[model samples]
Target: MQFFPIFLRSEGARIVVSGGGETALAKLRLLLKTRARIAVHAAEADPKILDWQAEGRLSWVARPVEAADLDGARLVYAATDDAAEDARVAGLARAAGVLFNIVDNREDSAFITPAMVDRDPVVVAIGTEGAAPVLARKIKAGLEAWLPAGLGARVRAANAFRPEAEALPQGRARRGFWAAVFDGALDGRAPEPLDRLLEAHKAARPAVGEVLFVGAGPGDPDDLTMRARRALDRADVVIHDRLVPAPILELARREAEIVEAGKTGFGPSTPQEEINRLIVGRAAEGLVVVRLKAGDPSVFGRLDEEIEACEAAGIAWSVVPGLTAASAAAASLGQSLTRRGRNSDLRVLTGHDVNGLADHDWATLARPGAVAAIYMGKRAARFLQGRLMMHGAEAATPVSVVENAGRPEERILAATLGTLATEIASTELTGPAVILLGLAPRAAARSLPLLQEAAR
Candidate 1:
C-alpha cells in the first residue's frame, strides 16, 4: 500500500491549519472532535472559523502561515484552496520537519486523511490513498450503521476490566474471555457486574488446542471459505500441502509456523505417517493447528488417515470444506458436472493410488452421457484412456483438462477420448490438473482461439 493507516495520539499535541475558506472549515469540523490544540493561520477568516476561535475551540491568527507556525506541530494541513498557496505552506511545513497534507491535493501531500467511523476507542478508518474518496465515504457510512452506538461504552467497560481478565492464561484463555465479553456475555446494561464476569471466566477450565483440516480451494485465495480464513487467522501452526498456492498460505498469521507436507503424483512425497504425527504433535502442544489441503479435503485428500491419527492421539479435529477443483474446472469450462437430461450422476475419480493406476467402474463411466471429474490424472493419462476405451467408452468422447484451475496461470486443453493420451503427452502438462470426462468448454467459452483450435 502506498499509504499506511495509523492513529496518531492527538492528546496534548498541536495541529496547524493554513486556510480560511470552506476547505479549512471542513477540516476544522473533524479536528474539533480530537483533543489536540488546533491553530488556524489565515489573513481573513471565515465566520464559522472566527466563531470557533471566539468559542476557544482553536487559536486563529489573522495572517498567512509562516515557517515558525509549523514549529512543534505534530501535523499540518494546507487547505488554502489556491494551489500556489497550499504548495508554499507545504514547503514551509516540510522545512519544519512536520508531516503535512494539502487538502484535495493528494499528489503533493505527505499524508492524507481517511473517512472515519468514530466510535471512540473503536474507530474505523477507511482510506483509498485519495484515489476514491466517495467510495471511502460509502464504506464509512456502512460501518457507522453496522456498529452499535453503545459499542464505545461496552469497550470502555472491557478496558476497565482488562486487569482482572488478565488473571486468565494468555493465548486461548484470554482471547476466549475477550470474545465472550464482546459477544454480549457481559452486557453493559445487564445486572451482572464486570467483576462477576471476570470471576466466572477465571473459574472456567483452560481450553485445549485442536486441528482444523482446511481446504485451500483450487489455488485461488478468493475461493477460501470464511471458516477456513478464520482457522488460518487463529492457527499457531499451519501444515500445508504442496499444491496449495502460496497466496493462500500467505493468509495464515504472520507468526504462524508453516510446514510443507506435500505429496506429488509419481514424485517424492512426505510420508503420510509423518504428516499425521506432525498434526498430533502440534495439537498436543496446546497450539491451534491447521492441516491445509488443496481443494476439498474429503475428496482424494487422504483425510481419513489423518483423522484416525488425531483420534488415536485423543486430539480434537474438525473439517473446513473448500471449493474442490472439479467445481472450479467445470465453472472455467462453462459447464456443469451433472446436467438433468444428460448425466444423472457425477463421479469423482482418482488417476492413481497406492496400487499404481487407480481402477474405477470403467463400464459405467463408458456409458453414453457419463460424466466424471478425474483428479491426479495428468501422469496416468495413457492408463486412464486405455482402460476406458477397453471398457467400451466412446473414442470421440469429449475430455477437457484444466491445469491449475481457478488460478491466474490456469490453462484448459480440450480433446476427445481417442486423443486424450496423445493430447496430454503433447501438451507436456505440468502443475496440478484435473480431467473432465464427457465435458467440453461451452460454445461461448470456445470463442477463445486456443480452445476453438483444440475443439476442432
Candidate 2:
C-alpha cells in the first residue's frame, strides 16, 4: 500500500528526462519502449543518447532542466545523481501538473519504474514499491523463463479471432470459447477453423466438451505441469484418482465439481466402467472435464480404456504426461534407474494382472545387475521376493521401497532382496509406493548393518 501502480499512456505524449549518465540512459530505455516523444535535458549526454537524438527517437534539449523545460510535458524523470538538481526538477514538474519520478529516490518521486515483462500488448509488471528491486528483477527473470518467446506473436494471432468470438453471447459462452482457444493454441493444439468457430458461436451450439487426461505428477502439487495446471483452472469437472493428492486437487477452479474415482489395492474402488461413464457424462454436459490421474497416466493408469471410451463417445481428448512414480521414487533414493556400466535396460512391471499378481520373465529379471521398478507391488511384495529368489536372484541384491514418492511423508526403506518383504511388512504404508529392484538407496552402504539384521 506504499504506492499504487498505474500504466501511463505515453503514445505521442512528451516525456522529459534530466541528467546524462547511466541513470538517464536507463530511464530513456524504458521510455523508448513506448511511443512517447522523449526530450532529454542534459548539459553533456551519453553518446547513445546523442545517437538516439540524431536518429529522431528523442529530442535533446542540450541544457540543464529549467522551469520552461517542464512545461507541456506529460511525465518527467529527474535521473541526475545530484539531489539538489533532482529536487528542483521535481518541484518544476509538480507545478507544471506533470507526473514526476526521481531516479533511485522513492520518497522524492511520484512514481517508480517496475520490473516489466513486455509481450507487446501483453505487459506484466512486478514492483516491490521501491523496497526490493533485486527481488523484483529475480521474479522478472523467472517470468521471462516461464513465458514463451513467441507469446506476443500468439497473442496477436488470437486478436484476429476476438471478433469471431464476439459472435457468441457475452459472458460464459464467449469466455469459454476464448479460453479454449488460448489454452489449446498455447499448448500447440490446433484451434478450430475461424469460420467453424464463428458459426458454432453464432448458432449458440453447445461447445463440445473436452476431456484432458492430466498427469498429476507423483504427489507434489509443484510437479504438476503448466499445461496440467491450465487444464485444472478451466475444468468444470475434475475426475481424479485416489493417488492424486489433495493439494493437487485443490488447484482446480473453485466451482469445479470434484469426483473421486480413486482405485486402491484390496480396497473399495470406483469401477473403471463407472469412471468412463462419469467422464463422458460430464463432458456431454458441455463442461470442460479433467481426468486427473496420479503419475503418468500411460503407466498402468488404465489411460487407454478411458481414452477409448472418450473416442467412442466422439469427445475430444488430450493427455498431459506427468512424472511417473518410478522417476520420483528413484529421485527419493538418489539413484538412477539405469546407471552406466550397471544396468542398460529398465523394466517397469505391475504387481497384479487381470487374474492375480502378474508374472514376468523371471530369468531376465533375476539376472545380476538387472534393474526394475514395480508399481502396485505393496500387497505382492512376498510373492515378488519369492519369484525373484526362485529364479536364482541373489538375496543380497539391493532393493529400495519408496512410499509416497515426492510427498512430505515419503519413506525410503533400503534392504537386500532377502528382507524386502519383511521390511515392507514391518512398516504400515497407506500411500502408493514403488519398489526398485537391483538398485539400492544412496545410503544403502551406510545402512548395510540394519539391512542385514532385518533380513535375519
- What's the lDDT for candidate 2? 0.86
Candidate 1's C-alpha runs over 4 A off are 185-192, 250-256, 426-429, 445-456
RMSD of candidate 1 to true structure, Å: 3.0
Supply the global lDDT for candidate 1: 0.89
Which residue pairs overlap in candidate 2's backbone?
Answer: 242-262
Give the alpha carbon lDDT tens digit for every residue of 104-210 in model 1.
98999999999999888888999999999999989999888888788888789889888878788877777767766777522434434667767788888666779
lDDT of 2 by residue, 302-367 (tens): 999999999999999999999999998888777888989988899999998778999999999999
Best by lDDT: 1
Give Cα distance to truth, residue 40, candidate 2, Å.
Answer: 33
TM-score of each: 0.90, 0.61
